[model samples]
Target chain A: MSDDIRKKVFEIIAEQAVLEVSEIAPEHSPQDLGLDSLALVESIFAIEEAFGIEVPFNANAPQQGDFDISSIAAIAAAVERLVAEQRGA
Target chain B: MRRVVITGAGTINPLGHSVSETLAAMRAGRSAIGPLEIRDAGRLSVRIGAQVRDYVAEEHFSRQQLGLYDRFTQFALLAAAEALAQSGLPFPDGRTERAGVVLGTAGGGVGTWDESYRAVYEEGRNRVHPFVVPRLMNNAAAGHVSMRWNLKGPSFSVATACASSNHAMGLAAQMIRAGQAEVMLAGGSEAMLCFGGIKAWEGLRVMSRQACRPFSADRDGMVQGEGAAVFVFEEYEHARTRGAEILAEVAGFAMTSDAADIVMPSREGAARALAGALADAGLAPEQIGYINAHGTGTAANDRTECAAVADVFGAHAGRLMISSTKSMHGHLIGGTGAVELLACIMALREGVIAPTVGYRAPDPECPLDVVPNTAREARVEAVLSNAFAFGGFNAVLALRRA
Candidate 1:
């Protein structure tokens, strides 16, 4: 189920970005996916809503580079980290 | 400072294209809203919009010209032609240098954007249409208006979201006051009723499923609408000297930003604008007779706007006739203020307040005399039209009978 969520998030990112989702490697950043700042923000919203997970990042924060070049695998790891932190895992 | 007055007005709203036809429709208590017809509105929660019908673009512009302009620009040109013709302003021949154009828009070329988006995303086309830039540009309405009428003075576009047209009108008034232009064409046009435009708004999650019910307890949210409304504004003295039929004077104007949330409205911002516009117009709150509320049918906007009016006008708030023409015309977004301002001008001059068409039960939070679903005969000296837009842009225009 969580893998499906990651795939859906990637689909949205692919919608905005010029690159295909399959072309992105797990270690590659979102810039590698050709996502600009606007696309990144939109992807964040799409991911949050798609996964029903709250990532610990401010929407308006300048620290946007913290999620630099986020691939679907990296995004899945980040969500897992956030969910684990919330669950006290 | 020179005074600014409305010398001419034209519109192509859901009600109708001509002033008489629209006024007749309003008087008959007919709602221009129905099911969406622009294509692929089947999936959206809100399928109803106040759309202009029987408008053939090819009839107005040649095929080549149509390729160069967006639907919004086409609407602007058509409405501008009507206004200029009514004003009898001789193509602005001698006053070309001193004449100008300013238009307001929310989603400049939404139809063009939708088509291009399909070409790129669905069709997998890497290259966009060459006319994409010109068709989707926000300034295209102003550019077309300038070109059509040979206006050579200061020309630009004002975009304050839904409040765009009011801001445009207010800025044009300032231009005349500043001696930058002797005559100005100002208003707004919108053509965002496309499939993608409606889908984009659906993401906001604030559209109503039923009809727009301004100030009503059952009000859910705003219905999307499209049209154009333009007004010819001349310096008060210039209009009088030219023997122009004065519609109304642009008495006062004020603009304020909430500087807060993008979607949430602020009562303080609205209240300050009301007081500021009154002060700018050199009129007392008591003297103002009618108010055309922004009244987008959103729960937050209606409540906040009601509180603002009550705060600013005190006892006068209860006594004054207030209505949301959006109830009938639907929310035209960028063009809403201009169309509503025309309604305000006519209300002040004709001494009749348009009804809030879909009003049924009044919201307890918005407990004011919203004139309630029926046009009322009353003596109106001055009228106020309030327009609040997305991202906290708020503009108000005060108009008085000539």
Candidate 2:
């Protein structure tokens, strides 16, 4: 389930960046992958929709949002944790 | 003081898509108000609107441009292009830095907001477009125009409800008079004929479901319209030096606040604006030949406007021609004043008076010579365009033959 979530997250991020999923490495920064602030927010929205979980996002202070967006792996990990929490709740 | 003159004009309203087409339609006294073709029209109580029919975004803009340009921005760009082309005043070398853009719009990108909000709230969709913020900003149209024209001077947008375009044009002329800019692209645009735009106005109960018949006895209310009009306002000397064909002189402008009611029209405030405009133009009330009234087809607006005209112009009001083109083009809200300025230009330059169509029964209160149902040919030296917004904001502009 965790692998499936990570793969889906990478696909969504790649789509936003207008790149192939194979080109987006897990360790690469979303910004390095051409996801600007606007595209980053869109990726977060897509993640929230795919997982049916809320991802905190502040347009003014994006880095301080509850969701970690430092890199593709970090975002996937955060989404996985939120999904687990929602299931447990 | 520097004098400002209109060198070029363009418009894309319900009546037509260019200045020539719109003026021809006005000359024919044609009505553009008809059934609304917007999405979800069956759900709206107001089913009629003056929409700019046959406008396709894909035909004018590329995919990348369309992603950033909202409907209002597109309208402004189209109108601006025509105005600039007609002016033939090439911003040569350093002159580009001295030109600016000032546009008015009440709902800058409400259509974009409406679609995104509906997607997230009603359709249960989480992901929306990435450029939504840039697309929905109130200054988006101004910013795009500035970037396109390389206008590095003062560029901004004004939002004063229905009087926005008048305020914008007035301010742009002031900038030229104050030596801030040599040339300014001034006008306004609106695209609030969407589902959400009409739905919100439904609460106000001021919309007409049938047609807009301003200053008529059987008039119900104002109908909404969408489009844009743009003009090139240049220093009179600069235009003369370049051999540009001057359309009309923007002689004077005055704005007065009612400070009385939020929605109801005030006779005192309207009269003050009319008087102030005449004073600013250094002309007597009797010198004016025509007046494009701010007749919204509402009972309150028509009566109060007539009383104010009587108070200010007195006996001269009976002699001058007073008409409301809103009866034909409907009301463009923030963009209405800019479009109505076309009628004033026609009256001043071409000796043509656009009529107030859809006149059914005569209202004794509005007893002015409203050129009803047919266009009349008359030589008018000067005209005034009146725009009174909701919130008691009044702005009147004076124009004279060039």
Q: Compared with the true structure, what per-residue lDDT tens digits does model 1 show for residues B255-338? A: 999998787789999898888899999999999999999998887899999999999999989899888988888899998998
Model 1 is docked with a DockQ of 0.04
Candidate 1: lDDT of B281?
Answer: 98
Model 1 TM = 0.83
Q: Please compute the TM-score of chain B alone for each predicted structure, in the order given.
A: 0.98, 0.99
TM-score of each: 0.83, 0.81
TM-score of chain B of 1: 0.98
In CAPRI terms, model 2 is classed as incorrect
| Candidate 2 chain B lowest-lDDT run of ten | B201-210
lDDT of each structure? 0.84, 0.89
Predicted candidate 2 versus true structure: per-residue lDDT over B60-109, tens digit per residue: 99999999999999999999988998999774344888899899998899
Name the lDDT value of residue B50 in candidate 1: 91
